[model samples]
Target: MSRQASRRARSIALFLVVTMVASCGTLPRSGPNKREIFAGSVLQEGDAFVVSVNPRVTAATAVVPALGFSSVFRDAGELGADTIRPGDTLGLIIYENVEDGLLTSTGASASLIDEVQVDSSGFIFIPYAGRLRAADSTPEQLRRLITRRLDEQTPDPQVVVRRLAGDGATVSIVGGAGAQGVYPIERPTRTLSAMIAAAGGFSIAPEIALVTVTRGNRSETAYLSDLYKNPHMDIALRNGDRIFIEEDTRAFTVLGATGTQNRLEFETETLSAIEALAQVGGLNANVANPTGVFVFRNEPEEIARAVMGRDDLIGTQRLVYVLDLTRPNGMFDARDFVIRDGDTVYVTEAPIVGWNRSVAAIFGSLGQVTAAGSAVGIN
Candidate 1:
């Protein structure tokens, strides 16, 4: 061959060899791979946040109280009964008797008045009387005030005031509860358990459920676990109070070549990839491929555009991080990778996965064809 032609051919051959080597997919031996690893540092048992609950106030303590009370009585004596504020409907019953010369005559009267709507001025209007301050008075207190006013107008006036409608009373139960609804606190008696029973009891698993109380804009979260651990956590329901049962918000699923394949739930706010793997009872000893672990995440494109400065291809923006588990240094990188909600982790087996499937298919086909030929020969 000519020298120039030989040189060109050699260069082409070298390029082809390099391309083939690259296509063969060699394992990373040195330097950090751009892919993120899913591993977390081992946290000791005491390392987690532990709030020491007093036994006196825990659910164990509250159990006696819960058992002592009936559902009916608990529903009746709740917080709404004790306080009467403005904007309450009052039912008035008045009895009057008049005596004539020979025979005595008596008359009974009952009336459902329009709501004694307490004005912003903190005054309520009665039928015969003008506006009276009733902003902080209970139903019984309001009754005495109305009676005094009537007595001033006449002698021995009989008056009874019963609160027909309480101040705007509603309790919101959310999260893990059997029913999530806004229940009206219509009467004086409404207990926490009663409210829960009214809306439906705790339906979620105790470990994963959380109850939050929000009054006005103030919010407080209570672990349902704590409710069992401490009785004091259960508070009386107040007007405009909200009860929220939060679902198991922290959880991840591990699948493929794992000892156990199932969705794992966590109570902690954050979980690393390694922690998620551990929760799934660790990887399968025989089938797990140490070098081919992958975490598939549906990342929003906006995040990539901001952080990685990558091209925002509308549909293709989602990223898949393929991690190598064989390297010891990869463990630290995996620790840094935080598990997000609905994240799926797939630990793949070796390339023999495809070969095994192919072999199984070939055997099955051979058996079927052999059977068909025998039937044809018989025919």
Candidate 2:
């Protein structure tokens, strides 16, 4: 080939390489590289507070939303099944020593009152005893009061009061329980766990099952397994309490150069950063940068103070935690780092990947240039 043709071809190839290198930033990439991420950090006058993963950082951000019962639930003592309420039915039997007494008939010394319904005012009426307050009194207490009232006319009157199951204290169990119904607060099912067992345990896996109890104006939620582990969570249930058992809906999003890019549900009650990565099939071996793995989250003021070692922050702070698995303790820090709900785990592409893509573009353009020069009889 002539010198002029060779020089022209060399110039064309050099220009193609320069163009490709200049436009390398526009190459298709999963996300920003490590340098780009650091460039847009708070240290670089950016809004996001970029932190490197360490033991202290892991511990500071290890806070998870806890579930438990308050004093209203834990301190509220169990209700007695025998305590007469406004809606209870009392079975009464009146016996007199004389054959033809006030309450008894001829030859019959006992008179049976099959059903005595207590009114909404908590009063029950007998034939000769008149209206009497039956609520707030036990069966034995009601028996003594009735005997005293009937003893005025009948000789040696004996009164027997039995409390039968009626519209008394009850709780409604629903959502993810083996059986959903309203169960009375009996002696065996007065507490929270006992009532759950009465309705037939949780229908979902205990690991992800959540039980929420709503009493009056307040409600609290706790993991089903936590009730067994923490004694205080198994509180005493109250009347009109509503229980709902459901699966945990907390999840995190995975993106960039990982094995998969999707939203994943928490597999356990508490999830770690490493386990979250594994759930998405881990980092992509071909293109992932081991030093550029990042978890993006919005931390509250308290957590932001602990993590940034500063307290001047206000409102929710945007945070980006960089995890360098190449470090000796990086894997350990990741194992201890808590992956909270709504977190975004992103893996940047390797540095070499961009250069490789640029090089491939330049060479492919050079090959076409070389073939065109040969067709024009320049080579």
Candidate 3:
């Protein structure tokens, strides 16, 4: 071997070694990463933006804070207990002694008046008794008034005032109910639940429904499922009140390396990140980067200000939250993170390993196809 040949061989070997090392894998470059939203500091200590809820999803039921509905209907109205209102019909009966002509035509006979409705003026008319105030008076109070007005015609008259159930307090229910239209409340103190039940409950599971109660000019809304947990939401219903139930319009989207990807309806009012992930078929273990799970949302101004300490928010705005499931505490932290409506949950792809497998599979398929074709040749 000559010196020239030895030198050339050494250079060629060195070049091959360098190429193999380069082809193995390149260093991760420093640049803007995927799913990066500027103005968000990396989730760390002292950052208020990443607010983590402390409760885990031990069960299917999740906690949802009432949105301006809790304080409004927490207590029942005192007026509807026994008070009568106009448009209500009363069944009346009169009793008097047979010997006392001043009081009697017959013994313990019912009033000829089948039923009397309180007029718009809040007055009911009797045969001997002139118009008497019925509205704002209890059945007992109206009974006393009716007997007292007939004192001149009868002696110690006994009277009964019964509310006509057919014409009593009623509520009109529409949407998401088993039965729709107006339903009469049998009693004055019928609750929200009773009225809904009277109208035939909800069409879908109450777990994912919202109830809107409108009483005259005032109206309020609450999650139907939460009513079971919070009784105050089941407030008493009044005459002419309107109740409606419908499936929740709020939902979040899931995409990227998750087992299932779609805009999923929340069967619950609210859910945390871990719970949301579970609901959407969880992370795709084969391709998901355990350290790159993220939730993108437009947080309300108050939350952004309180949690992120940012003042330049125009109502609700976008925010990016990153969760690293590679660490033991990552899932626990995600469990405590609340996912709001319109949120996007994304699990990014793991880079080098995933690409290597994909490339190998493509090459392996090509080699196998070529070998198979070579096996059969023209004779």
Best by lDDT: 2
lDDT of 3 by residue, 73-184 (tens): 6665634555677778778777764454443454534444556888887898887888888988988999899888887777777888887744556789999999999876
Query: Per-prediction TM-score, please?
Result: 0.49, 0.93, 0.72
Q: What's the lDDT for residue 147 in model 2?
A: 91
Q: Which clashing pairs does model 3 show?
A: 48-307, 53-336, 103-154
- Candidate 2 lDDT trough over 10 residues, lowest sum: 20-29
Ranking by lDDT: 2, 3, 1
CA-RMSD of model 1: 14.2
* Model 1 CA lDDT for position 327: 74
Residues 326-367 of candidate 1: C-alpha lDDT, one tens digit per residue: 676566555556667767777765555544644555455545
Q: What is the C-alpha lDDT profile of model 2 across 202-288, one tens digit per residue?
A: 889899999999988899998888889988779997778999999999999999999999999888999998999999889999999
Q: Regarding TM-score, does 1 or 3 come out ahead?
A: 3
Of the two candidates 1 and 2, the one with more favorable lDDT, higher being better, is 2
Candidate 3: count the clashes: 3
Query: Candidate 1 at residue 320, lDDT?
Result: 46
| Per-candidate RMSD, Å | 14.2, 2.1, 7.6
